[model samples]
Target: MGNINKRGSKDLVVDSDQSQQDSPTITVDNQLCDAIIKEDCSTIKALLRSHPVNQPLTILTSYRLLFEQQTCTVIPIHLAAEYCKPRSLLCLLEHGADPEVRDTQGHTTLHLMLLHWPIVSSTWTKPGNRIQRLMADIQNNAVSCLHILFQHGAQVNAQVGNSNKYSPLHLAITYGTHPILSLLAQNGAQVNAVNESSMTPLHMAADILNENMIKTLIACGANVNCVIPHNGNTALKLAVCTASSKAGQLLSAGVGCIRLLLIHGAHVNAQDHEGQTALHEACCGGREAIINLLLEFEANVNILTKNGESAIYMYLQRSSNIRDLMVLTRLLYCSYPLRLTNRQGVLPAGIMLPEFQLLKETLVRLARKPLPLEDICKKNIRNIYGKKYKYYVRQLLPGKLWNSIYNCYDLADVLKGDL
Candidate 1:
């Protein structure tokens, strides 16, 4: 038999030597790698002394080996910048290890420095010493490190590559590091830059409920209604979806931003790709304050989502408290009639089930008057459900409802035909 055997129709040949030569070599030396990984200064210094000449490949290989394995305890640089000896980091830098090299997660040395700086310094609190001094060192150093990376031509907008798809700006906003955000923006980092999920720095600020960050991003020209690439959600929509007290604070800061967007020509009634408007988000988030703001901007109440859900529907679905339900009920009354249906043709009254029934009964009582047949019957009915309904209406409306009712009554002659 030959080295090559005959196949069904043709002879086959194999080159073992060629195949062996084609295989990839590990390239990086294991001993230097282990020394870096262990952060064994003696071992690393000895290796450097033995090598005599600095090589980029050798330095990078050692640096990466330690970083990849996370032997930060020994390799102090892998520890927070504060905990790590400056000399070791300087040594690595001198040996041509890229100061801006990121880890497996794309978090650069600067990113690790910002996050871990605080952690390392948390252990060094002194009673008489102002804590600000310690924080100042970390902050100033973090700024300097960022400058170093920027000078070295590191990517200013590199994404973190996870659920947030966040860039450095996203991290700054999330961490409430406004100064860092400003530096990144000044250095050409995208202000409205979105993450993998299509969320902007403004959106992240909203997520963290950082009011000042929201203002900063808006001031820097972040698009207020910049939609998520995946679902077309806007920064405002995300804020409204978060119903915490922190969410409220962010919404207040964002109120001016929303107004700016409107004045600059954001579509008040513009729906997402799914046909949901900002109104839906405000309602679904149960944020009456934001809802009122959307209304002021003339958001369309009648807009329906692809699934045939309207803002009122979402509001009703999300209403967990009496106040929330009451606010939504009032808004619904001000909008289309409860009989107005969505794309599915399901009316508000039909969709809310038991809640709708109770509300309907209340409305009927509120609207009812004694038939002209008898004053006594009218008074009795007033004494029954009518009085309580009026009281409730008074609480909701004060002078407003009565004024509206007077207007309606005065216009009744013209509306009589429709009635």
Candidate 2:
């Protein structure tokens, strides 16, 4: 019995020794992957050297998607880029990890880098000087990683095979800085590439009211008049609608973004599927600055939606506050027809503010009067030139004197500067 017990003890000791010998080999790959995700540069270099240089390390990420097994196999470069680690990413690239390698989910190194963009972009809103600097550093590191990948022949326009089929440029526009956008643009990304929604980068920019992005995209050759297939809404119309929302009001980028679109020749009279123009949207939302800006850009004051409601009628129907009357005044100043009946068959005068009761008769009489010859000539000239109206007007007058004299035909200060 004693001899049998000694043999069993010896067997147990050998099993324990064997287990110790197998553990490091079993875990070394996982350790390397963890070191990479943690951005441990030196440890990554050390572990990488232990493996065959010809064989790249891969991360086998396992997850459950409904009833299926969604196993994703990604390389060290993708992990490095995903974590925004520039140094480790450069290390992987130098060790011959292909920058164009796509994971099972079809995310290239660049896509992984961009996946973290929103967090970095939104860090500016966090309140702290140290936090701001840290965010800047993180952003710079991510940019540097992209530069390294581009140096290794990464494709700038590769579309993620996800359902949305978003190109790198589309992702960049989601929450990108100007420098990163310029980098992608310079690297041959198609500025007008549309996603599954037929939304160009410009559409995203305008929807978010990103004035700087709109300017950059225009410079990069984005078609200002590109329309969405789903809604037939151009970027200009989309900006107007979005700006009328509470999110839009808070950012206050609506007027500036719309102005940029107009300056770049977005058709002011462009209509959406609803037959509503940007002016109609502004009026419905009671956006005063947008209404005036639209007027300056020659948005047709007489244009009616498919519903048979004029912009003026829409304004009166949804007028919320007393400040909304300011928009109404601008609409009238731009010659919005008071005679046009809404779908409700009511005249704009029928809904006049109580304050306007004193001037109601005068306003009704004025609408009945035809435009004078002086106004007629100006209208004809403006209609003839259309987009070039301001350019010709500037050349004809040749000074600030033109703006003062032609206040009736003047563009906004934003568009006027370009003139």
Top TM-score: which candidate number? 2
lDDT, residue 387, candidate 1 = 20
List TM-scores for all candidates, in order: 0.59, 0.71
lDDT of 2 at 189: 90
C-alpha RMSD of each candidate structure in angstroms: 15.0, 12.0
Query: Residue pairs in steric clash, candidate 2?
Result: none
Task: Kindly list the per-residue Cα lDDT of model 1 for residues 1-419, writing each as its tens digit.
Answer: 11111111111112233324432221222344444444566766666654432332222111333433211111223332323234445555555555455555556655555444332233444423555565555455555656655665667777764565778787776543566677788888889876777678877776555656766676777777677777776666665555324545554545554554555556667777889887777776565566766766656666778987767666655325223444544444334323234577554443256645555454344335333444334333332323225455456565864444322333233223221
Point out the worst 10-residue segment of candidate 2 by lDDT: 1-10
Give model 1 RMSD, 1 decimal.
Answer: 15.0
Which ranges in model 2 have alpha carbons more than 4 Å from their true place?
1-26, 34-74, 118-133, 321-323, 336-339, 342-419
Can you tell me which runs of candidate 1 are displaced by over 4 Å?
A: 1-95, 117-130, 161-165, 244-267, 318-330, 337-340, 345-358, 361-419
Computed on alpha carbons, the lDDT of every model, listed in order, comes to 0.52, 0.69
